[model samples]
Target: MSRLLLLSPLLLFLGLAYLLPLSGVMLQSVTTPEPGLQNYSAALGDPLVWSVIWRTLRVCLCVTVLAVVLAYPLTLLWLKGNTATRVLVELAIMIPFWLSVLSRAFGWLSLLSNRGLINSWLQSLGIIAEPLTMVRNEFGVVIGMMHFLIPFAVFPLASAMRSVDDRVILAARGMGASRMRIFWQIFVPMTKSGIVGAALLVFVFSLGFYIVPTLLGGGRSVMIAELIYLRIFQIPNWGLAAALSALLMVSIGAFLVALIKRAGVSTT
Candidate 1:
């Protein structure tokens, strides 16, 4: 009874903040502009909707893979480095969190745009006659997302790496195992949970990304989130938007369930 009383405020917060809004969205998805599943039926039949969903999945996949690949080395450095090195690496990972997502998206825009610094430098050195189309495309969107997600991947990876017994690594070295052999045979296998956790974390977060994709993709690489925005704000299709929102929420919920299972989290 005491625990329930203690949790009442939090439960009320969740009811108000999440359950109510979600219920409203689901109800609107079916009941708005006349009742039935027509909105979902139309969304499923639309080629453009399918294209956006697939594109969103692809971008999320790219970001997950890149974040894990890049974060592995950084995590290793963080785990094994000296105090000063660890501080610098940690600062690099955490500093970006202080900035708003919109600011980071715009920052990437300045650096990746056709007339941006990178292209200007390349052009000045006569490396290319024209500016490269970096922003307003999938490449730019992937780059921005990769940068944002790598930090998320690193922390989980670091946690996993810390759990590894260093003495086992020493024993492998003592047995004349090469550094590469030990890493592949011992280190990576032991950290498999962390890798999966990081990948799932990054992928799930990537699916709902709006500002970064919208600003960087410039409509050329429109993702599901941006499409939802267009449906609601521009096209004024509330029913369709609500349907897409509900679908996206379901998909993310599935991924989160998988994440919890992978982490061996207790639901009780």
Candidate 2:
């Protein structure tokens, strides 16, 4: 009772800050522009909306895969390395968290733009007659998102990896299992929860990204969040924006539900 009372303030704050706003948005989705489901119907039928959604999913998938592949090795290093190695690896992973998303996006923009560092070096080296187009496209968005999301993936994966039993792994080694075999047959199975958690974390977060995609994509690669922005602020279509917000919320909720179901199954 005492603990519950102590938590009431936090509950009240959350209700005010999040639940109320979210409820208002959901309500507006159905109630705006003289009511009915016309906004959602239009959004569903719009080819541009579908394109944005597909692009968002594709980018999210790419970022999640890249983050997982990169984070797995980094997580292993953080967990198993010597003191100095662990410190260096941890610093490398943690430094990104200190930077703002806008700064990171512009940093990538400088390196990846046609006249930026990478292209300049390539041109000076006579690698190509012209600079390669990197930013202002899906490739640039993926790079920026991966940089921001890798740390999120890493920490969740690290938490899951920390829970893995070393003794079971040692038993596998004692049975004369090769490193590859042990990794494939023993280590990976034990750490699947981490992999799933990290993948879902990266994917869901990637869906909500606005700044990186907006700045790096350079209008050519608009995503769902940016589309919502255009609808409300640029186009001044409040009803459609509310509907899109509702859709985004639904998509995120679906992913979370899937994650919860998978977690339940894994535990069983």
Candidate 3:
């Protein structure tokens, strides 16, 4: 009775927020269009929808990989650095969290456009005769997402690296293990959970991401999240939209399960 009372607020919040809304979406996916599996079948059968879903997956994976690559080294450096340097690096990572997603996307827009900072710099250096197209492409989307996700990846990675026993690393070194070998053989395996956690975080969020992908992709690449909006608002197909949302949920859930299983997370 006491435990139930204590948990009431959280349970209420979940009921009012997630479970309710998700139930509505899933219910509509099946029932709104005459109580059948037609929406699911139609959505699954649509080539365009499949393409968008596949693109979303690829973009999410790309961002996850790039973010992990960018973060792990910085995290290691942060773990090893002196107080001042660590403070600076940590502050750099934390700064992005203070900014809105839209602001970051638009900021990248300015930087990645033809007349943006990078292109102008290259042009000034006479590296190219004309500004290279960077924005409005899959490349821009990945770059923009990596900016947002690197900190997410870094936080977990830093925690994992910090948790690693220094004595173990020292023992490996004492055993004549090269720095690279010890890092690869010992450090990497120990950090697998953190890597998977970050990958799950970035991958799941990126797949359903709207603002950054919408701004950077410029319709050249259509992520499933954006397609859901287009279907709901532009095309006004609630059933189809709901079906796509269901698909997105399933994909994220399946991938999350795979990640958890791979990381050997003991739920019980």
Candidate 4:
């Protein structure tokens, strides 16, 4: 009873600050445009909405795959390396988090632009007659997102890998198991949960990403979050914006549910 009383303020705050606002958004999404399912209908019926949704999913898929692919090797290193080396690698992974997302996006924009570092180096070496279109496309978006998400994927996988006992691997090797076989049959399965968790986190983070995609994606590529910003601020279409936001929330919720289910997270 004492603990319950002590927790009352936190519960009240959550109800007021988080749940209330979320409830309002849901209400507005359903109610603002004539108090019916019109907005949802429009969202479902529109091809552009579907396109944005698909693009967001595609970018997220690519980012998650890239982050995991890069992180697996890094995880092994972190798990097996000496203290100093592990610290250095971990610091490198975390450096981007210290910088603002917008700042990172701009930095990538500078590097990936047609006349930027890579192109300049190529030109100096007489490797190409013209600058490559590296920025303002899907390529730029994926690169920027991968840079941001690799650390997220790495940390979880490294943690999981570190939990694995090296003696177990040694014992497996002693039993005539090859290095590749040991890794595939033992290490990979052990780290499966962590990989799933990292992929889910990276996918969810990438889904609502705005600045990197907006800056690097140009006019051709549009994400749902950016579209929501435009609708609210630029177009002043509150109803549609709220509807889009609700859809985003629903999508995120569904993804989380699917992730938890697939990862076998126990709810009880």
Candidate 5:
């Protein structure tokens, strides 16, 4: 009872800060637009809306995959390295966290745009007569998202990896197991929870991302969040915006539930 009472403030804060606002948004999404399912029906019927949603999902999946793949090696290096080296690598991963999203997007813009660094270097090297179309497309969005999400993916995996029993791993190695066998059978299995957690974090973060997609995607790469922004601010269609927002929430909720189930399975 005392512990429950102690946790009440934190629970109340979560309810006020997170749940209440989300519930309000959900209500607005369904309640507006003539108080019917018209908005949802429209969202369902609109191919353009579906396309944007698909693009968002595709980009998020790509980002999650890339982050996990990249973070795994980096996390292993961190685990195996000396304290100083590990700290340096961790700091390198976190440098971007301190930087603003707009700044990071602009950095990519400079690197990927025509007449930018990559193009100038390519031109100097005589690789092509003209610059490549890297920015203002799905490629740029994926790169930016991967950059933003890798650190998040790494931290969770590193934390989990740190908790793994080194003696158990040593015992496996003493039994003549190869390094690959040991990693796959022991280390990877133990860190499965962290991998799922990292993937879930990356996916959820990607789902709500707006700035990176907005800046790098140009007009061609429209995401659901960006679409909702346009509906509300650009088109002044709050009802439709609210409906889209509701759909976004539903999608995120469904993904999270699925992730939780997967994580539970891995832990068991």
Candidate 6:
């Protein structure tokens, strides 16, 4: 009872800070523009809205995949590296966390733009006749998102790895299990929780991303967040913006539920 009471302040704070605002937005969504669920049907029926949703999902999947591929190796490497090497690698991975999202997005633009460092070097080397269109596209968004998400992916993996019993692995090795065999059969099975957790976390973060995609994607790459922003500020459609926000939440919730169900089945 005391513990429950202790948590009440936080619960109250959350209700006031998060739930209240979200409820207001959701309420406004339905009440505005004639008090019907037409906003949802209208948004979904529109091809452009659907396209934006699809693009958001596609980019999120790509970001999740890339983060997994890059993060797993780095996590393993971190475990295997010497103290000094581990320190440096950890510091490097954490740089993203230290930097603001705006800084990171601008930094990518400066590095990937036509006159950016990469283009300058490539041009000076005569590698390409002209600068590549790397920035202000899907490619740039993916790169920026991957950079933002890899460290987040690594944390869960490292945590799961820490739970692995080294002695059990050593025993398997002593029993003539090859390194490859041990990795696939033992290490991987143990760390799957981390991988799944990281993937889902990264995917969720990618869905809410506003800065990297909008800025790095050169305004052409419109995400759900950016769309919501435009509806609220530029297009100035409060009803549409509220409806879009609700839809975004619903879509994300559905995906999370499906993932949880799938994980439950796999574990069983």
What root-mean-square deviation over C-alphas does model 6 reach? Answer: 2.7
- Best candidate (score: TM-score): 1
- 202-231 in candidate 3: lDDT tens per residue? 887787788888999998888988999999
What stretches of model 6 exceed 4 Å from their correct place?
1-16, 254-268
CA lDDT, candidate 3, residue 50 = 84
Instruction: Score residue 136 of candidate 6 by CA lDDT.
Output: 84
lDDT of 4 by residue, 1-268 (tens): 9999999999999999999998887888788757988888887798988898898888889989999989899877776889998898878887878999999989898898998888898989999989999888889999999998898898778777877888999999999999899989999998887888889888988888899989999756888998888888897867777899988988898988887786666233
- Relative to the true structure, candidate 2 reaches a TM of 0.91
Q: Summarize candidate 6's per-residue lDDT along 1-268 as a digit string, tens digits.
A: 9998999999999999999999999998898878998887878898989999999999999999999989998998888889987998899897878999999999999999999999999999999889999988889999999999999999888988988999989999899999999999999998998888889878977898999999998889899999999999997888888999998898789778876875677558
Please give the distance, in angstroms, between residue 152's alpha carbon in candidate 5 and its true position after superposition. 0.8
TM-score of each: 0.95, 0.91, 0.90, 0.89, 0.86, 0.89
lDDT of each: 0.94, 0.92, 0.88, 0.86, 0.88, 0.90
| Candidate 3 ranges beyond 4 A from true positions | 1-14, 258-268
Q: Candidate 2 has which clashing residue pairs, if any?
A: none
Please identify model 5 stretches exceeding 4 Å from their true place: 1-27, 258-268
Residue 107 error, candidate 5, Å: 1.0
Count of clashes in candidate 4: 0
Distance (Å) between predicted and true CA of 135, model 2?
Answer: 0.6
Residue pairs in clash, model 3? none
Candidate 2 overall Cα lDDT vs. reference?
0.92
Name model 2 segments beyond 4 Å from true: 1-17, 261-268
- How close is each model in CA RMSD to the real structure? 1.9, 2.1, 2.4, 2.5, 3.1, 2.7
lDDT of 1 by residue, 29-82 (tens): 999899999999999999999999999999999999998999999999887999
Q: Give per-residue CA lDDT, model 2, range 97-131, as digits (tens).
A: 89999999999999999999999999999998899
What is the lDDT for 143 in model 1? 98
